[model samples]
Target: MIMKATGIVRRIDDLGRVVIPKEIRRTMRIREGDPLEIYTDREGEVILKKYSPIGELSEFANEYAESLQQATGHVVCISDKDNIIAVVGASKKEYMGKKIGKELEKIIEEKKTIMVDQNADGKIFNILEEQEGDSSYLSQVIAPIVSQGDTIGSVVLLSKESQVKMGDVEKKLAETAANFLGKQMEQ
Candidate 1:
């Protein structure tokens, strides 16, 4: 679906900024501090799109899961309070958009990271033991995403093999992922 072009143009100032007209800004709900994403097509056309930082952070969580998986060769889960935002090294297809439930709610409330050594199912991580008759995960690390002094979400790293001993390094890395997400959400 294409939006009809209003086509109002303003010359870029010496400081390299072009003003978007008030009418367009008002229509787009572009507030003073709202971010705009600039993109260029192969045909050399420039497009300025409104940025949704929440979507960006969720995508960033995907990368965060992959990197953490490489480090520990484990399953990693990223969540945004009510939703399972991203997961790596596990069958996340069925888990995506699922509620985090009571366990994760506690994590957010306390704003603390937890290291689970064993579980028949990932109940403590707020993951289901079975989805379509398959196990979700057994053991995991649960970290709270704290932003601006409030717990907003969680990052959970699950063990793919045996139960993982969440050491200081692992704990720090898990916390770092949560903290990094917190910082991004702040921006």
Candidate 2:
């Protein structure tokens, strides 16, 4: 495991509450009212993990990605705010559990649906940082998943074949999947 020492320290208040530094919180994407899971190892090290509601639906996301891939004959991926949780396609191994790129994070924050093609710009934004500057995809559709007025995740449809064009149909499919996933979170 990789560990970094921030050299920052805090003390528990009278109520046993320790304030997380603002810089660390921003870097970890911890917002106000967000749930965090606290854990302590036998080694006496404490850990905090940002809880992801969409992560709890990993099974459902996988099933949905598979169905979407079959229906559209394209790559399908589902991601929570920070990482890709499910992927269905030949490239599954390349993306599963990968941290999402900043562009994808921005889309989730804006709660936007976007369709992009290789020819539109010099190169499409990387879906994951590991694939930065790689333009192997021919087309892509991205839709943000929002639940209870909060954007939580995204659904993506991607085509690697030049013959396959992503159009309104693919956009609608991605949007529908995103909407469905968002609704599932409410239950």
Candidate 3:
């Protein structure tokens, strides 16, 4: 996530050592024990990046959602801070890569689980209904994936029937997913 307008250079010592500025490291969330990936592009320029397990998490979320499809009978979506990276159940192709608007972004901002039931009102409810196309789902549950105390993503489950009551179960499922992803991130 770090971008540079101009290059900053550093000299490598005899031991092949170069220090990344503390500010840059902080901005990139590059902790001391974190691994970095080094690679060369077609032009042979070296690129350094904080290693991420996004691919693995995406696959895991997809598989998890698929497994829960029968029991939940709802559309399950997994999203990073900005995008829908995985989904199961209903075919909302439109959901993929959709920039999660301010509505769900609040979950990450507040770092909490939120429910937008049919009778709910306010920004969250309005946004949920608008995003899902007019309250087609009877309820929505969104839980933030907290990694090292920061919300990195979210798990969203939408249920279809008013008669079905799964408030606690859906919340727990989201928490389960977040814990699962958090463990994966630690590796």
TM-score of each prediction: 0.62, 0.88, 0.66
Model 1 / residue 49 / CA error / Å? 21
User: Would you list the C-alpha lDDT of every candidate in the order shown?
Assistant: 0.72, 0.89, 0.70
**lDDT of model 3 at residue 86?**
80
Residue 92 error, candidate 2, Å: 3.2
Which residue runs does candidate 3 get wrong by more than 4 Å? 1-40, 43-55, 120-133
Flag regions of model 1 displaced more than 4 Å.
Answer: 1-56, 119-125, 128-136
Candidate 3 lDDT over 56-173, as tens digits, reads 5777878877776666787788777656778788665767656666667667669878877774552223223137454567788787877777666788887778687557887887
lDDT of 1 by residue, 1-187 (tens): 3657677768999999889899988656466766679988897878888664444587788988899989988778787655678888877776676765665667767987877665443343555323342244556678888877866678887764554555677788899998898898898
Cα distance off (Å), candidate 2, residue 58: 0.6
Cα displacement (angstroms), candidate 1, residue 58, comes to 1.3
- Model 3: lDDT of residue 103: 68
Candidate that scores best on TM-score: 2
- The 10 consecutive residues of candidate 3 with the worst lDDT sum are 121-130
Ranking by TM-score: 2, 3, 1
Position 163, candidate 3: lDDT: 87
